[model samples]
Target: MDNIYIYMLIALAFLAVADLVVGVSNDAVNFLNSAIGSKAISFKTIMIVASLGVALGALSSSGMMEVARKGIFNPGEFMFDEIMIIFTAVMITDILLLDFFNTLGLPTSTTVSIVFELLGASVCIAILKISADDSQSLLHLGEYINNSKALEIILGILLSVVIAFSIGAIIQFFARLLLSFNFQNKPSWYGAIFSGIAVSSILYFILVKGVKNATFMPDTLKDLVSSSPFQVIGVSFLLFTVISYLIIKFTKNNIYTIIIIIGTFALAVAFAGNDLVNFIGVPIAAFNSYEAWSASGVLPSNYAMVALNQPVGTKPILLLIAGLIMVLTLWFSSKAKAVVKTSVDLSRQDNVKERFEPNFLSRSIVRLSMTASEKFNSLLTPGSKRFIDKQFAKPVQALKTKSEDMPAFDLVRAAVNLMVASILISLATSMKLPLSTTYVTFMVAMGTSLADRAWGSESAVYRVAGVLNVIGGWFFTALSAFVAAAIMAIVLYYGRVYALTGLLILAIVLLIKNYLSHKKQSREQKEADSLERSESSSTQGVIIESAKNISNVVKRGNKIYSSAINGLATQDLKALKKNKKNITKLSNEIDDLRDNIFYFIKNLEEPSLAASNFYINILSFLQDMAQSLDYISSVSYKHIHNNHKKLKFTQIKELQEIDAVMETLFGDIKSAFASNSFTEIGTILAEKKSIINLVTEKIQKQVERTRSEESSPKNTTLYFSMLLETKDLLNATMNLLEEYHSAHDEKVAPARLPGSADPSLEEE
Candidate 1:
């Protein structure tokens, strides 16, 4: 009996570890995405922080454990075996459910699953207790049903969603306002001080209050610490404050990216520490009870341990170890992210930066809001589009960029989450209600994601509605778990002959199904790879043939460069415009050709077509540079329109230099095309370095002189316009040049066209 008990305890320990790993891995997606999506911190940093959080959450989770132990059905009413059956059913079901969701990358609530599973198991146990020797039952089933913690859990979930949504919106609104002001006036010390105070207060309350029971400190240590809780808190607060201040001061000149990273990590740690037990608490509780009964040589009871007297034993230590395991899991997750990057369709992510064009609803709202403002302004004069643009549109544009639009709401939501979680957890502790942190926090994030319109217009409202429906579905989860556990218990009790054997068979079947599914997926993937390769090879051949045609066009164009340069330098607007038109036509042809190449590359079936596509992209970029040169030449002609012969000596010098550079680039392009050799392109590209530097310096001087002279409005506008055109032209040229140089360095060989020699075959 002693040995059996010892083995059960060991098994329970292992189960606890398994729960920790699964729970943390699933929950990780909740907070991890925000940090990664924002590019605010590295995966390694988040993992470390999350690990610490899990450790702390597990260690301090005694308060929640007590709630779980006593708030469900009366465990004393059932015999020892019944209790063991219910617990075992709940644990197995909960683990299977959560791990399944995690594998699908769906963010389900572990807390909801566990609570429901326990409810199901407990309900089954209750029904059996009522039916078996009712006269000796500790409590009636009616009384248990009416007074279970299910109601409280339901209410908590509902209230958390509402409160979290409201607070997240309000906080984000104000935070955006502050951010806008800061952008206009640089981040002031006052703003930093206020933000720090607010963040610190929220962090302390949530981490300290929410995690009170989950701490690693033993009773003795806790008693010692609590005797002077205020003093301890005060000293810790002071120490952190000093450190934070120094960090802020040191990073004042740099962006506060490091601080944000550190804060995010700390938050992740806290989340792990507080949430891990939600996943594994029941299994640990059941295992411990099973061990105690097996040791006492008595039939196991269905009765749950009393709330206050529940044994924590080494569970907190086990939880801390679980946290460490999560860090390693996070490392694996990062590697997986990198491996999938190329294949993953990032269209949704790209949509994040798409311009916010107003739909009918938004346009109506904007029109309505501006009505009053427009009427007031109209009293002075009739409103023009310029008025609307200046007062509202421009400011909004600037604010949108500074705030990063709705994504800025993520930080606000996180902050409010900590505050709300602390208060709710504290209330639950005081009132002895069983609330789930996982359900509350995740629902809150979901709500904020909706409110901020992060899901974009098409899906935002529907997703929000779906999330609410899911919350309702959580009740079903609890009901199902309770029912499943009860049924399993009944079968185990009355149909004992094949109970264990049936369960083993069921497990084996599930394992086999999973294995077959994986194999099928692998085979499909391989087939897809083979098809892709065949398609890519054909596409590569077409792109290489297209490149040869483009190269010939480029070589022909180079012959006309000297004549174009003379027209560009002579301030002959008519002649320059004609030359520009010819260049533009060539550029358009090249662009069309490049687009065809890209389209072909994309449709290629081969897996290695990505490399081929890269080479084509480089060629396309070079074409863009030729077009930009034409635009610059056009701008130069326009600038000297009125005073052709009186063109500024400085302007003339700049044009001559630009002309010389273009001539040299054209020669290089011609040489590369003729010899099918791109090796010297990189050095030729680097030759632009001095010219770019000179142009930038000249523009700066011109801008400064104009500002100092208090030039006329027309002069100022003209000066700035010309300067901007120069910059744009320079950038476009450099972009193409860089692409060419990079492609040359990569040494990607284009596939042989029809009637062409294979470059590889001809080598050496």
Candidate 2:
């Protein structure tokens, strides 16, 4: 009996280690993005700075551990067994939730997850307590929980997004007005002052929010630092300002780089100081509970854990270990890169393509903002407008550098982002609000991007939509954490070790599966990229490069068409579903290619704009091929997924004939594209006619069967659909082959492809 509870505590210690790894993987983007996005310093240097911050932060974060113990609920209200179960539920839910978000490559609020999980698990156990104690009525439940603190946490979740975004925008609006896009050429003193203000703010934030919790700090120093805050600010500003000026005056050092490096360190330290509690606090509390239980000589269930309400301190050694895990994760986790990419993609200054598409809401918002801005411009005096325009004008060097580099924004904006977010998060920390570091950091970047014109008109809709999607994910995180924790708490309360064994195993399996899936996806993307031919410079390169793209499309298109037909014939839902996913991926790749036409044109040397026209036409034709496959695959998967009756034997037989013809078409087209020869295209074109005729015959037979022999409406409709789509697919396939043949005829043909859009490719 003693060993059973002891083992649970041991399992929790292991979970604390795992949580630190996953938690850091997800949260690394919070601090690393601004530094990396600005390219102010090398990535290795940024990690080193952030790693040092984490180590120092962990050592200073002794006081924050109480949040995990008594911040969400009153520990004195629950038995040792019930309290341990809640801790177990919260840790498990948090690791899974945070890991899952990292897998999606989206940043979510870990603070929100931990808080809600605690709230949820507490609520669940509280309900059980009420139900079990017949004499204690529902009205007495208030004594079991700290409702006010929980409300503050929930409010903090909502507040972080709005406040972070607004403050970032306001600060950046003024910062850009002062520095402009050409701030690099400004006088050293101007840069120094900006650096001073930023450094001072971060200094105050770090000291007030991060180190205020330090148990080892001398009392006199702590008092002076806390009480004389304005003096500290003045000294910091003077100190960093002189230091910044001296560096600029004496060396080739960029003040922005200094700010970015310092900012990264401060944010990382703040994260460890604050959010580390979310990871290790529970395990520490559980261990403390186990200690008390051991000394009491009471059975685990009978021992009440009143010690949790006391101010227990976290051991410095444990903090060092957690920080070490975080440092290692920052150094090696690939998922951290994925999450950082999302942050950079949303805030990039260029009009590059986005991963998330613009939806209707995004379009509407963009449209309204544009209209309002135009109206506002009209209201400005002529002189004011002219001056404002000059202030906003980007320098030529900055524009040229943007074309060459992948930095999402300039270092000034990066500095502003780091300064504002670190300030806000630290303020929240000192105020005892569990502000979401992820929310504050991510939205702050978005807000600064908006003010700095990174969300230019060309990509604003998509960028806005991406930000909204991430924000929506934050709200979903809270709901999911609550529900999952509640349900898990119930399972542990009743199911005990049996449930713990199963869930722990389930968690391991899920983490492994996500790891493998991410690995496979990364490998496939690299392989696809390696096969891509360089962009067309001359007519010959256009021909050669276009051939590679067309051949790849043909290979994928053939599989899609084959899977759709066979999946329907054999009712293989998995095959059809896999094809559906492949088709979507192919479609996105083509769409991205299509969007890159602008950059491709920009890169082309003078007198090669005609190549742009030819390139565009080739892309259009290939896109049609992909869409043709996508529609077929999607419809096939849906029909089977809905449990629609499989096509009759005769219908399958006719479809197989069409499938065979289409397979030949794919083969010949692939060969033509691969070899950049159309000698076989004429044969392929002739076969298209016979294939269409066969599809006509198949449809006519389906119609005849529909009138008399067909028993299932689903069967008849599906059969006729596949046959007609195959005919349209044949037309698109033949037309694309013909256009490439035209490309062969005239090495530099006109911009327009000869093929018409295949009407059948349109979604039904």
| Model 1, span 456-514: residue lDDT tens | 54433334344444454556556666666666667666754366447535644654564
Candidate 2 yields a Cα-based lDDT of 0.82
Q: Which 10 consecutive positions of candidate 2 have the poorest summed lDDT?
A: 755-764
Task: Please give, for residues 1-764, the per-residue lDDT of candidate 2 as tens digits.
Answer: 77767878888988899999899988989899999998899888988899999888888886346767888888888888899899999999999999999889999987788888998999899999999898888887788878898788778878888899989988998888888888888888989999999999988888877777787768987787777878988999999899889989899688898888888988888889888888998888889888888899887778877888788777778888888898999998988889998999899877665878899999998999899989998999999878766767776544332242567788998999999987887677656676788899999999998877778878899899999999999989999999999999999988998999999999899989998998888787777632353355555567667777777887888888888888988889898988988888888888877767766776666788667777887777777777767778877998999999877777777777777777777777777667655455556776766777778877787778778767887766666667666666677777777776665557533333233222221212
Give TM per candidate: 0.56, 0.88
In order, the Cα lDDT scores of the candidates are 0.51, 0.82
Model 1 misplaced regions, further than 4 Å: 1-17, 56-64, 134-139, 142-148, 181-185, 209-211, 214-249, 253-263, 295-311, 315-317, 333-434, 450-456, 465-473, 508-764
